[model samples]
Target: MRIPSTRTVPTRSRTAVVDSVWSDAKEFLTQFAQESRGATDTDRRLREVRSAIEATGTYRHTTEELTFGARLAWRNAERCIGRLYWNSMTVRDLRHLHTADDIAEQCVEHLRTATNGGRVRPLITVFAPDRPGRPTARLLNEQLVRYADDPRSRQRTHLAQGLGWTRGDKDFDVLPLLTRTGRDDTPRFHELPSDAVLQVPLTHPQYPAFASLGLRWYAVPAICDMALRVGGVTYPTAPFNGWYMGTEIGARNLADTQRYNLLPTVAQLLGLDTSSDRTLWKDRALVELNLAVLHSYQQAGVTITDHHTESARFLTHIEREEQHGRTVAADWSWIVPPISASATPVFHRYYDPPNPHPHTAFVHHASAADTH
Candidate 1:
């Protein structure tokens, strides 16, 4: 899954509920109820959902349907390469929550449960959806734990300033949760407690001095802003996460030129000749950086997957899905590891095109902030 950038895109209109949504909802309810319970009361259940939607421009999903939908969304995530564990995900229904404080508290709870004492589990918290006249609260952070760079710092990223983050001694000072009360509401920032967050300071087994770099990351990668759509209803405040593949942190978050951009800094520390791109100094530093990320997370007793191991496991997942007679849809650009693409098993194959309508899906919701 693509991590949301801090930059806000311009808003258009609230997404219209899917066309033929009622029919689709009925089909899903009928099929799922029949398969799971051998029930043929789909016509009745379909009327139930239809009545609710026609009355309120929305419908409610039963606990069974909600759980199944959440899992299906993970299965349908086209950009994600970790669909192997989609069935094992834990879904928390927080559709009752609407206030900013309530939403913030549940978000904290999600982090605690997903962190799972460093044995990270795939989890999602589904918050209330935006109704015809009532817009649910929204979180502004791309991930639950992201840093704020000083506006004056040369390394500041595109969307750094004006989120009410204070400058610190280091570039990576953790930012508070920024949320909006309603669709038209101004954002409010809340400071998260230290205990609620579990962070692993980066250190290298080979380069003992790497600890001095003051790099650290949160245990959970909880994404709090994406919309979770299931059976024609859209929950705008749903937050979810799976455990990290180390390259996501080392290669993209920390090393991307648009992000922390730490390759030059690390290369300087490693005494690499940065005078020429011909020397492959960046490539060398990247390897060491990833090494530090893996080593640090492991020593800290956190769950993290290495690219080589994860690549092989992805293939195993593909085989298993095929055996079950399910198509394995994938995006090749995302399936291959950021580093050493040719070395992995996922590099040589073409994936089936994504199915347009999966039982569940993560849909991007244009933020109210973007409208102004």
Candidate 2:
């Protein structure tokens, strides 16, 4: 699946919302800490942090960038995984161009369109220089320079060596030629193609770039994965439900702090019941985590195993209780049968004694019979 792209507007808006949420969370934590020490500086510190974040725009930009990056990472991860399993194309297929010029043109087009029409050029790699009709690396470089130097060329461009030609070269000085003529010109490096590879860089500017390639609902799994990471779980197949439960509990703890001043209705919506005992809190947290996992898996087109029969039964009971306003007969006797053992072993004999060797048996000596 392609990575989802963020639009200009929502990207900005999401940054703001996430920033606010983080600020509130931090403030709540600080207040809780202060309360433990019986200090009254919570309100002052909260105001100071909020104003600082707002003034510096740090919260907005950082959160926006983070959200974008996470989304991009999720998308690229899916693509990489998909390619591992399914892609039939190879590097040679991608590198096939009619001529060196054609390849250069294709690279230039990609740079322009993909990078927002930036005035940047591509470094082309030419192979097999001595062979008939194959363009020499030197000749290709010259052509790129000529194209960039043309008066009609509104876009400033540059060309540099690719690995195929760069080999054995010691004192290459193409940097000056590729450098911008004026300070206002766009600066883009035409790195050797070997420096570039098929794998997406985690630090690429587009790492956080958003695209609307798939359904928005597909984001649930991605977000859940991020949530898991935030809670310090490293392995995907680990008991992520427990980690999610811990996160919910942490969020509840934050909500209960005086700094949050969370509305009772909002708290309830978030699965936080202030009056619940510690044991109930733990149970509720686990249930919420399980529900989140179920929802996320469903969004990702995964089916949960029928092993959660007990959970299903419990949910059914709760629904019945709400609808009837009274307790109904509870059937807690459901039992899953154990696997049965294999049937009794049957031995197959390959050889059979001669049906009586009647003559030999009749002739058996008295001594032989006694020995037998």
- TM per candidate comes to 0.88, 0.16
Root-mean-square deviation per candidate: 7.1, 35.4
- Which lDDT values do the candidates have, in the order given? 0.79, 0.27
Model 2 bad stretches (over 4 Å): 1-49, 60-69, 72-188, 193-195, 198-372
Task: For candidate 1, write residues 1-372 as lDDT tens digits.
Answer: 998799653333112443356756876686567546544577787777878766665678877788888888888787888888988999998888877899888888888899999999899998887765667788876677676662323222223335454544466676677778665676776777778789999999888788888888878888765788887777888889999999999998889887788999999889999999999999999999999999989999999999999899889988997897877888899999999899999998899988777656887767722323
Clashes in model 1: which pairs?
none
Full-model lDDT, candidate 2: 0.27
Quote the lDDT for 217 in model 2: 14
Candidate 1 residue-wise lDDT at 140: 71
- lDDT for model 1, on a 0 to 1 scale? 0.79
Clashes of 1: 0
* Candidate 2 displacement at residue 214 in angstroms: 34
Which digits, one per residue and each the tens of the lDDT, describe model 2 over residues 75-121? 22211111111111111112234343444344433322222222111
